[model samples]
Target: MPAMSRSTEAIVRIDSAAKTVFAYLDDHRHLGAHMSASSWMMLGSKMDYEFDAGEARLVGSKFGFHGKILGIAMAAEQVVAIRTSPRLKVWETIGAPNLWVIGRYRMGFEIVPETRWSRLRVFIEYDLPKAAPARWLGLIFANAYARWCTGRMAKDAARYFETAGGQAVPSIG
Candidate 1:
């Protein structure tokens, strides 16, 4: 059996500059503050960078996922040549010793510049396991969860920017 792939996307218009939005998105510590409660819960605790490289060299920066049921982790990189704007791609890695055997997961955020506000488009792709029970269950729930999380993250990001005067607040916990 072959691996199954699933993807979902969400877009939100934020009342902030594209560079500001991109800066906020680039910081791993501020991720939870801009993510919905459920999304944060699913993503687990605040992420800590495993590599000392700065945001400019995000391609190799690894962050701990820290989820309860799923010990998934993520690596940051650039998106495939799609748009000219700044895009950040975060994909799951199965290098953790105690992590669950979930399939490949990738999430991309494309920040498009606008006149006064910026458009943040988020995309999530999941490659489900090929096995029996996990496949069926993932097909039924993972897709929906991913979509929900994507949308919620976009919305929360907008709200965060709006409330914080277009600045990213430091992550709590």
Candidate 2:
């Protein structure tokens, strides 16, 4: 099947420094903390495994979501690759062998420094395969869902920074 791509982005101003925001994003475990509760329900359970990738975090990590369907086990895997600069952090996702939902995914966070805050621009792109009906459904809803999720994540992050005194909190689940 041919592959189709969809992307979405959301921006939010965080009352923190770019370094602090990047630090929060660098940790793979902190990912679920930024997502909405409904999103977490659809994802079922989250499992994360991270390995040392030398200079950067999340460069060689694997995030898995597992759920049950009709008494059968279902799982999805996202292998991560990260590139980091002073102001930009990019996370690229390559579909694992067992998971065929999305072909490729990339999420980038650009932290623009402001006078007393930082503007975080979150960009996410994913490729959907056209071979299966499920993939078609993903294509239809992926963009909107991604946008909603990203917006929620950005807002949650901002709120966390605001209430937690910009401290890096541990990942949830």
Candidate 3:
């Protein structure tokens, strides 16, 4: 089957400046913390990060995650596509990603500065897997996984800013 495009987004207000949040999320290791640890969402698997092209900060940079689940290897390579900094940055998967559900995807985040805080929007636009089992699983779980992915990014940012070493929350607006 041909891959189909789908998207999921999560919006949350962080009690911090747009630049601050942008800098934090610009680091893949920081924004992708959820995937690095063992969690129910990952089915007891943890993926390690591989960075290239100036540590994956500039456009055309490549980075990936590699791990295993039940002895089955999984990997996804992504390249930075659009990066404007302090406001918007987008990256898309390259080649056919070997994973459990959704396949190729473009994921990014936007930060809108407010008076005393920032509104953050994390998003993932994905395609159904083309391989067996995962393709079928994509039909049933792609959206759910996308939601979890984006939501985790947003929630992590909020938590970062709400805790020590971050700005105090005045209000989420």
What are the per-residue Cα lDDT tens digits for candidate 2 across 1-173?
A: 12236778899999888888877876644545533133452454433343344323645555545544334454555554555644776656445322234445677678898999999887777776446755875667666667865786677778879898877555634
Evaluated at residue 153, the lDDT of candidate 1 is: 71
- In what order do the candidates fall by lDDT, top score first? 3, 2, 1
In model 2, the Cα lDDT at residue 33 comes to 52
Clashes of each: 0, 0, 0
Estimate candidate 1's RMSD in Å.
Answer: 5.5
- Candidate 3, poorest ten consecutive residues by summed lDDT: 164-173
lDDT of 1 by residue, 1-173 (tens): 12326778999999888877876766644443433133443555333334244432355544443323345453322222222335554544433223223355566688878888889998776676566666676667776767776887788778889898887545533
The parts of candidate 3 lying over 4 Å away from their true place are 1-4, 165-173
Model 1: runs farther than 4 Å from truth? 1-4, 32-57, 70-87, 90-102, 167-173
- What lDDT score is found at residue 24 in candidate 1? 70
TM-score of each: 0.67, 0.72, 0.92
